[model samples]
Each structure stands twice: as C-alpha cells, then as structure tokens.
Target: MITLSLIGIGSGNPDHVTRQAEAAMNTAEVILIPRKGAAKDDLAELRRAICARVLRAPGPVVREFDLPVRDASGGYRAGVEAWHDAIAEVWAAELADALPEGGHAAFLVWGDPALYDSTLRIAERLRGRMPIEVRVIPGITAIAALTAGHAIPLNAVGGPVAITTGRRLREDGWPAGHDSVVVMLDAGQAFEAVDPEGVFIWWSAYAGMDDEIRIAGPLAEVAGQIAAARAEARARHGWIMDIYLLRRAC
Candidate 1:
C-alpha cells in the first residue's frame, strides 16, 4: 500500500510550518512538488525551502512535476473536475515510478488541507487506482493569518459568518443571511460586485508572508484603493494569493 501524507505548511512563510508537519515531512520516503510554470515557481520554491529546513540528511527523494492548467472551456465546475482528474493521473504515475516498492509520500500543501485547498480531494482520486492511505497534518489557514495580520477576530459576538469563493461572492452578491463573509481565490477584486453601502472590508495579499500587503476600511471608501493595490502587487509579483473578510453594519 502507498501511504500519502497531505501536509499543510501554511501560506508561504516557513515559520508557519508546524512541528507536526515537519515531522510528517521527514517520515515520507518521497515528496512531490507541483510546478505551475515560471509565473508561480515561487510556490514550489517555498515548498522546497520548507523541506530543506525540516528534512534530515539523506532525506526523501523530491520530485517536481508540471501541473496541468484548468481548461475553462467546459465551465467552472466541469473544468475543475477535469483538471483534478488530470492532476490525479500525474500524481499516480509519479508515485508509481518513484516508489515502485510502495511506500510513504508527502505533498506539501498551502494552508490547511481541509480548508479551501483541494490537495486532499485530489489525493482521494488515487484510492481506486492504487492501494493508498491518506493522512493530514493541519496548519494555519489563510483566514487565520488574515485575521491575525489585521489583529481582529474572525467573527463578531454571536454573529454569522460565511466562507465562499470569489466567483460565488461576485455572482451571488453577499450571501442572504450572513453578516460577515470571508472571500478566497478571487481572480480579481470581486468586492466591486457588492453593494458596499454599509459594508467594511479587510483585505490582505500574501497574508503572513514576509512581503504581505493589507488594506482595511469601509468598503465604500477603500474599495478602489484595494483594487489598485491588488493590481500593482499582482503585476510586480507575477502572481498573488489573497483573502478578505467583509462585515456588514449591524
């Protein structure tokens, strides 16, 4: 049987990597890194840096594989499912080749595996194709980091908060009964779609990382500023991972 460890190393910062995640990293015989072309190579580099910090000498055999791009021609959900299938195939082939004898392998995931991240779901796809068992080591989430970066609590006292993607937040507008919402995986400033009349926003790009940038204020006042900042950061870095919390006045 092939044992796979989905280790969350947090978002970008090596200091956020927990001892449990580090221990899990050392225990694996193979480590897989996904390459997302030149634009996002820093992601793979961060994973490597974390492994370098924790792995002992004569450590796990590390391998990098090109990640498949999501094909948007089939619509969002269908395209994501197809993309996951493609990723699973690459994973299965890489593991089979790396560990012909069947052993432990680990994939370094950003944030927690159980959060908005999909590494766990992709790993589940291997169950039918190979004899596999999966384990998770949780780490700090972008939400946790975002809140911490802003020195605010995740929710108000006895208030309802919802977590949703940028696409959903943009298309659905503020969820019906939610007083607060956390948005992730936004391709752009989805906040523009919101009414912004009585809402407040706390936005962060690369939260908890060394080069983190954050902006916060009444959405009406700072929405355009946040959009401009986000655009500048993304242009300079070639890529950006961001999350935000929005709260409506009581």
Candidate 2:
C-alpha cells in the first residue's frame, strides 16, 4: 500500500509551512517535486527549500519530475480534463519508479489542496492503479495572504463574499448576491472587463514572497496602473501568480 500525503506549503513563503507539514515531510519515505519549466522554476525551488529546511540529514529520498503542460487549444474545460489525465499518468509513473515496493510518498502542494488546486483530483486517479491512502495538510491560502498583506478584512460584517476565477469574472461578469469577490487564476487580468465605477480592487502578485507587489484603489483610477504593473512584473519574473479582491459599494 502507498501512503500518499498531499502537504500544502503555502504561497511561496518558506515560513508559511506548518509544523504538521514539516513533520510529514520528515516522515515520508519519498517526496516528489514537480518542475513546471524554466519560467516557473522558482515555484519548484520553493518546495526544495522547504525540504532543505525540514528534512534531516539522511532523510527521505527526494525525487523530481517534469510536470505536464496543460493544453489550452480546445475548450477550456476539455483541455483541462485532458491535461489532468496526462498529469495523473506522469504521477503514477514517477511514484511507481520511486517506490517499486509501495511506500510512503508525499507531494508538496502550493497553497491548500482543497482550494483551486487540482492535486487532489490528480491523486484520485491513482486509486484504481494502486492501493493508496491519501492525506492532506492544509496551508495558508493566497486569499488570506492578499487580505493580510493589505491589512483589510475579507468580508463586510454580515455580508456575503464569492471566491471565483478570472475566467468566470470575464465570461460571466460579477456573480450575484455577493458584496465582495475574490478572484484567482486570472492570467488575463479580467478586472478590465468589469464596470469600474463603484468597485474597489486590492491586487497582489507573488503574495507573501520576497518580491511581493500590491496595489489598491478605486478601480477606475487604478485599473490601468494595475494592468501596466502586472505586465511589467510578469516581464521581469517570466511568470506571475496573483489574486485580487473586488468590493462593490455597499
């Protein structure tokens, strides 16, 4: 049987790693890290740094694998499904090679697995192929970092908030019945699609990291600045991970 631990390491900050996650890393027989590409090498490096900090000498065996790139050519949903299947296959092969006898293996997840991350779904695909037991250790989410970074409350007292993706905001407009919206996975800066008249935006890139950047103001006054800033940051870093909160006038 394979004991699979999906440990959340938080948003690129080594200090964000919890004691539980640290203990799990030290106890696991193998830890698998995924290298997305040169552009996102810093992400993989963060995982490695976590291991270096927590794992003792002569500790668990460390393994690295290349992650499958998602195909965005077809419909978004269809492409994502295909990409997940590809990732599951890669994961199975790597795990099997690392533990031919079936042992404890861990994957350090970015942020919490229960959130927008797909590591949980990919792990589910391995159940039929092997006798596996899965465990999750939650970590601080990007939303939390964004809010904390800006020193703002997540919701107005007794008001509702919707957490969604950039694609949804652009394609569907703002969701109904929520005073505030927290947008994630917005590669295209979907905030530009909304009417900026009464909305306030608090945006952050690489939240909680050393090079973290933040911007907040009325949407109309600063939407262009946010866009320009995002462009510049992505150009400088080669990749960017960002999230934002939009609150409509009460």
Candidate 3:
C-alpha cells in the first residue's frame, strides 16, 4: 500500500512549518516536488528549502517533476480537468519510479491542502490505480497570514466571515448574508467590482514571505494603491500569490 501524506508548509515561510509536518517529512520514503517552470521557480525553491530545513537525517529521497500547464486553448474548467489528469499521470509515474516497493510518499503543499487546493482531488484520482492511504498535515493558510500581517481580526464580534475566490467575487457581487469576505486566487483586483462605500480592505501579497507587501485602508481610498503595488510586485518577482480581506460596515 502507498501511504501519501499531503503536508502543508504554510505560505513560503520556514518558521511556519509545524513539528508534526517536519516529522512527516522525515518519515516519508520519498517526497515529490513539482517544478512549475521559470516564472514560478521560487515556489519549487521554497519547497526545496523547507525539505532542507525539516529533513535532518536524509532518509527520504527527494525528487522533482515538471508540472503540466493548463491548456488555455480550451474553456477554463475543461482545461483545468485535463491539466489535473496530466498531473495525476505524472504522480503515478513518479510513484512507480521512486517507490517501486510502495512505501510512504509525501508532497509539500503551500499553505494548507484543504484550502483552495486541488492536491486532494488529484490524489483521489490515484486511489483505484494503487492501494493508497492519504494523510493530511494542516499548515497556516494565506488568510491566516494576511490577517496576522495586518494585525487585525478576521471578523468583528458576532459578525460573519465568508471565504471565496476572486473569480466568484468578480462574477457574483458580494455574497448574501455576509459582511466580511476573504478573497483568494485573485489574478485581477476583484475588489473594484464591489461597491466601495463603507468597505475596508486589508491586502497582502507574498504574505509571510520576506518580500511581503501590505496595504490596508478604506477600500475607496487605497484600491488604486493596492492595484499598483500588486502590478509592481508581479513585475519585479515574475509571480505573485496574494489574498485580501474585505469588510463592509454593518
């Protein structure tokens, strides 16, 4: 049986790794790291760095695989499905090559595996192909890092909190029955779509990393500033991972 551990390393910070995650890393027979090309080389580098710090005795062998890019030629959902299938094939190949005997394997996940991540879904595709058991090690999420970076609570006392994607926020306006929203996987500034009146925003790019940037104020006042900073950061680093929290006055 193949024991696959999906360990969350938390927003690209070494200190964010928990002791339990470190133990899992050290115990695995093989660890698979994905290389998402030059544009996001920092991502793979961060995973490697985490392994270096956590794996002390070097019992587990580390391997790198080229991640398949989504086919933009097709519609977004269809393209993502195809890309995930390709990734599953790669994972199967790596498992066979690395763990011919079928022992424990681990993948280092950024942030947490359960939050806006498809690793679990991809792993489910591998279930019937082999006898596999999945384990998850939770780590700090981008929302946690963003809120902590801004030194603010996620919700007001007795208020509601909503977590959603940038696409959802843009396509659908503010969700019903919620005053605060946390937006993730935002390629564009979705905040501009919402009515800025009486809204406050806390935005952070590269949260918990050394090159972190934060901008927070009344949405009306700093929406442009956040956009400009996001553009500059993406240009300078060649890539960016960011999240933001928005609250409408009750």
Candidate 4:
C-alpha cells in the first residue's frame, strides 16, 4: 500500500511548519513537489526550502513534477474538475515511477488540506485504484495568518464568521446572517463587489512570509491602497497569494 501524507507547511513560511509535519517529512520515502510553471516558481522553491530545513536527516527523496494547467475553455467548475483529474494522473504516474516498492510519499500543501484545497479530493480519487492510505497534518491557514498579521480577531464577540472565496462573493454578494467574512483565493480587488458602506476590511498579502504587506481600515478609505499594493506585488513577484477579512457593522 502507498501511504500518502498531505502535510500543511503553512503560508510559505519555514517557521510555520509544525513539528508533526517535520516528522512526517523526515519519514516519507518520497516527497512530490508540484511546479506551477515559471510564474509561480517561487512556490515550488518554497516547498524545496521547507524540505531542506526540516529534512536534516534526509531519509526521504524529493522530486518535482510539472503541474497541469487548468482548461479555461469550459466553465469554471468543469475546468477545475478536469484539472484535478489531470493532477491525479500525474500523481499516480510519478508515484508509480518513484515508489515501485509501494512506500510512503508526502506532498507539502500550502495550508490545511481541509480548507479550500482539493488535495483530499484528489487523494480520494487515488484510493482503491492505487491501494493508497491517506494521512493529513493540519497547519496554519491563510485566514489565521492574515488575522494574526493584522492583530485582529476574526469575528465580533458571539458573532459568526463566514469563510468564502472571491468568486462566491462576486457572484452572490454578502452572505446573509454573517456580518464578518474571510475571503481567500482572490486574484485581487474583490472588495468592489460589496456595497462598501460601513464595511471594514483587513487585508494581508504573503501573510507569514518576510515580505508581508497589510492594509486595514474602512473599506472605502483603503480599498484603493489595497488594490494598488496588490497590483504592484503581483507585478513584482509574477504571482501573489492573499486573503482578506471583511466585517460589515451590524
């Protein structure tokens, strides 16, 4: 059986790696790192760096694979499904080649696999077909990192917080009942979808990384600055991963 460990490294910061994740990394027979192409090469590099730091004893082997690009011709959901299928195929091929003996392999995920990530779904697809055993090591999520960076609580006392994506906010507007929302996977400038009145926003880019940037205030007052900063950061880094928290005054 192939033991696959989905370890969360936490927002691309070496220090954010938990001791459990470190132990898993050290114990794996092979570790697969996905390359998101040149634009996001730094992501793969960060994974490598984490391995370098945590795998000091180095019993595990590290390998990198080119990630399949999503087909945008179809609608978003369909495209994503196709992309996940392709990723699964790549994982199967790579695992077969690397671990002929059916040993343990690990993949370093950016955040907790249970949070807005498809690693678990893809791992399910690999089960039964490959005789695989899946394990997860949860780490800090982008929302937690963003909130910590801004030194702000995620919600008001006795209040609810809705975690959502940029597409959802753009298509559905503010979710009912919850005044506070944490948005992730936003390309940039998703705040425009909201009414902006009485809305407060705390935004962070590269939350746990050294080059972190943060902006928080009334949405109307600092939306422009957040947009400009996000644009500049993306231009400089070729890609950016960010999360923002919005609270509408009840």
| Per-model CA lDDT versus the true structure | 0.93, 0.94, 0.93, 0.92
Assess candidate 2 and give its lDDT: 0.94
**Positional deviation of residue 73's Cα in model 1 after best superposition, in angstroms:** 2.0
Give the Cα-based TM-score of candidate 3 against the true structure.
0.98
Model 3 agreement with the true structure over 1-250: per-residue lDDT tens digits: 8999999999999999999999999999999999999999999999988888889774699999999888899788988899988999999889988888889999999999999999999999898677889999999999899999999999988999999999999999898999999999998799999999999999999999999999999999999999999999999989999999999998
Candidate 1: pairs in clash: none
Tally clashing residue pairs in candidate 4: 0
Clashing pairs in 2: none
lDDT of 3: 0.93
The clash numbers for all candidates, in the given order, read 0, 0, 0, 0
Q: Each model's RMSD to truth, in Å?
A: 0.9, 0.8, 0.8, 0.9
In model 4, the Cα lDDT at residue 5 comes to 97
**Stretches of candidate 2 above 4 Å error?**
none
Quote each prediction's TM-score.
0.98, 0.98, 0.98, 0.98
Which ranges of candidate 3 are over 4 A from the true structure? none
Task: Tell me the tens digit of each residue's lDDT in model 2 across 1-250.
Answer: 8999999988989999999999899899999999999999988888888899889988999999998899888898999999999999999999889999989999999889999999999999989888889999998999988999999999988999999999999999999999799999999989999999899999999999999999999999999999999999999989999999999999
Candidate 4: residue 240 lDDT (0-100):
94
